[model samples]
Target chain A: MTKRAALTDLPLVLDRVSLSAGATTMLDRLNLAITPGAPTLVLGPNGAGKTSLLRVCMGLAAPSAGTVSWGGRTDRGLGRRAMLLQKPVMLRRSVAANVAYALAQAGCPRHRRAARTEELLDRVALLGLAARPARRLSSGEQQRVALARALAREPEILLLDEPTASLDPAATRHVEEIILMASQSGTKIVMASHDLGQVRRLAGDVVFLVRGRLCEHASVGDFFDRPSSAEAAAFIHGELVL
Target chain B: MSEGLDAWQLIASGDATLISIVRLSLTVTLGAVAVAAVVGLPLGALLALTRFPGRSALVVLVNGFMGLPPVVVGLTVYLLLSRSGPLGEFGLLFTPAAMVIAQALLVLPIIAALTRQTIEDLWREYRDELTAMGVGPTGRVATLLWDSRFSLITAMLAGFGRAAAEVGTVMIVGGNIDGFTRTMTTTIALETSKGDLPLAMGLGAILIGLILAINAAAWGLRLWSEQRVA
Candidate 1:
């Protein structure tokens, strides 16, 4: 999983970032930098700000305390980066069209969007359902479509918040393969997953957040085997760390 | 009995009043629904998607207006357009334009409130997905509208039904001016009051037909959405 791509400065940098919603801070003074081609997974218990951290990085939810600089710019121009959610959002269109819309909105040339959509659909095992209405698909198929949509952007960074939170075993395996394929193609993936086993299988690096604070950042092997913090240790043992 | 059958001959021969009334009903209802759509849809979208202190109050107000009495709305507009009222200079009362205005007012709240309900209900399910998908604010709002398009279509058709069959509002505002503001409902009322039972019954029959057409379309949309969901 540590097959790094071409070298660059940080693609996503969050400096002392904090998120507060109506007097409740979700992420507080958390500084982190994710580089090009790095697959970082955020893992913690319920209400541990894992999803909030992903949002701050994506500019969907603004951080209050500090800055988030993306590719040397602190702006919404980084919208080209894509994201996936646990509950897949499908439009009233064909699955291919959903992927195409993501690429097209990111300014991918019209001629290329179709080809890219088809390729991603194949990669996600949704090629057969390309013509199917996205809204008509089962939850698993919809998630695959969502994954295809995210990768079609050919994003410099991909953010996922519990993309497989509620799937059966077979569906989870299918989505995991799709994501693993996307990461192979050099998409920098930052994800949040409650499934620690999936995190172990997929993550190159792990970020541990607790009560709006980042407690640990380590290589996946190190974090799972010899967690540095008491919080991380408690979490590693099947206890609610939050 | 022989004269009673002549009403069928009038329908067969394409009677001018009958055709004109049908055409007028179509245009006035369509025109009013268009205006209400333009005004109420965006308001509904905003009310549903936005968060502010008065949002609940606004929702209550829009929902409350869904039950507003049509005649009361028509009477209010008639007063406003009367020569002595505030906007009397326009001389709009007793014209088809006034009828259109009154009808649009009557349906705007219904469209707005129902559209808001549809979008809000949809937002509850998909807002998190939309946010995580990085759909911009505009796209999120537009997506909710598009996703609930079937529901919106039915809401609009319901609004059209309300506009088409409405009697008191169009009667008061239009003055049932023959060959002009006269519509199916108003004509039916006029014919009924004048003891012209045959014409009144014919118009009533047409009104029922129009209602059937609208309900059929709305039901079709609902069926299509369900089939897709399946």
Candidate 2:
């Protein structure tokens, strides 16, 4: 029912981070810092390791080299963190129950669950469908429920991997509005997206990745106006960059 | 057709011996399923969620055991419950309790292996979501098992069917004690051996019908729950 207390981890820093599976490199010697305030957007083409980068930030994947630290600590518990995958998984239960499950996992009390679930479903504009089976819902609806579930944790850092990649225009707008509102409320959104339009709308900072390498990290205006790397320039012009 | 009609008559008339046998069959099979579920569900869930060096080997072992010979299970249990054997202190041999134990042993692998498969499939879908919710390993297993319960119920029913249809284990362990541990399967075996063709046919028909009923009830429950969930 209650939001998480103020952020304890800030200025999330990645140092020489590399990830490899077998002989294939996924992320290569990436060094970056994400300071508090403003939503950071990660952009890259297919197979550029956007998802892997988000997973590393969420502590879901281990890096083969270097380290990622949240506020100078790598051992902090992940209870205050939440990540949304590209295709969100819906629990085999009612929409409200999915949110309640998250709330219960976060140790919210039984008495508070009903109100909290109501608030979350309403927040996602899914209150009318609260009793519907989550998996039976449309993809866009399921994505909204996933967002509500993530918010149920009251996370300090929300990592999203193309959370709206499959949604229609209207659905995408709804999700973007919610993400923007969460950003304004200081949840500290770190999202990876393929939608340049979405990037233009929500990105305060942009981290451009190419073939698992960090090509550019700059404020959205600067990155768009005076592109630092050839890859960034090519990507901006809608040209494919390998 | 004549034997089936006679069976219908026996069932309609509620013959005492046939009723007792049917009741015992249900008791032993249901008991076996209960015991197997208690042990197997958690074991299956553990196998699904954790990774260890021999985990694949263990999974293979459990899967292999699903086809375990009921007669062999009977002999093993019979040996264990024999007077001079290790578990003989409880003196469970040649009783309905022994039959239940043997059937439970026979059914355990069925329940556990099916549970492992069902929960593993559900886990693949749920892993990211649950992990993001900060569910630790144990909680994730618990959640998955609970969510996949309808399928697990189907698994239990499969075990129940195997237990009820099995005569080998109950025959060896129960000794087919008339008016006591003579369940439908054992009684059918006994009647057929004694050349009582009509009684054997009747009991066989009843056994098949009872199993069909159980399956129908279980399927109905699954459908109802699914509808509610949907």
Q: By DockQ thresholds, what CAPRI class is model 1?
A: acceptable
Residue B67, candidate 2: alpha-carbon lDDT: 94
Q: TM-score for all predictions?
A: 0.84, 0.96
By summed lDDT, which 10 consecutive residues of candidate 1 chain A come out lowest? A1-10
How good is model 1 by TM-score? 0.84
Alpha carbon lDDT at B104, candidate 2: 90
lDDT of 2 by residue, A20-95 (tens): 9999999999999988788999999999989999988888888899999987788636747788889998888999
Report the lDDT tens digits of candidate 2 across residue range B13-117. Answer: 887767787888899899999999999999999888889899999999999999999999999999999999999999999988999899999999999999999
Error of 2 at A163 (Å): 1.5
Q: What DockQ does each prediction reach against the true complex?
A: 0.30, 0.73
TM-score of chain B of each: 0.89, 0.95
CA RMSD, predictions in order: 4.4, 2.4
Task: State interface RMSD in Å for all models.
Answer: 3.0, 1.1
Docking class of 2: medium
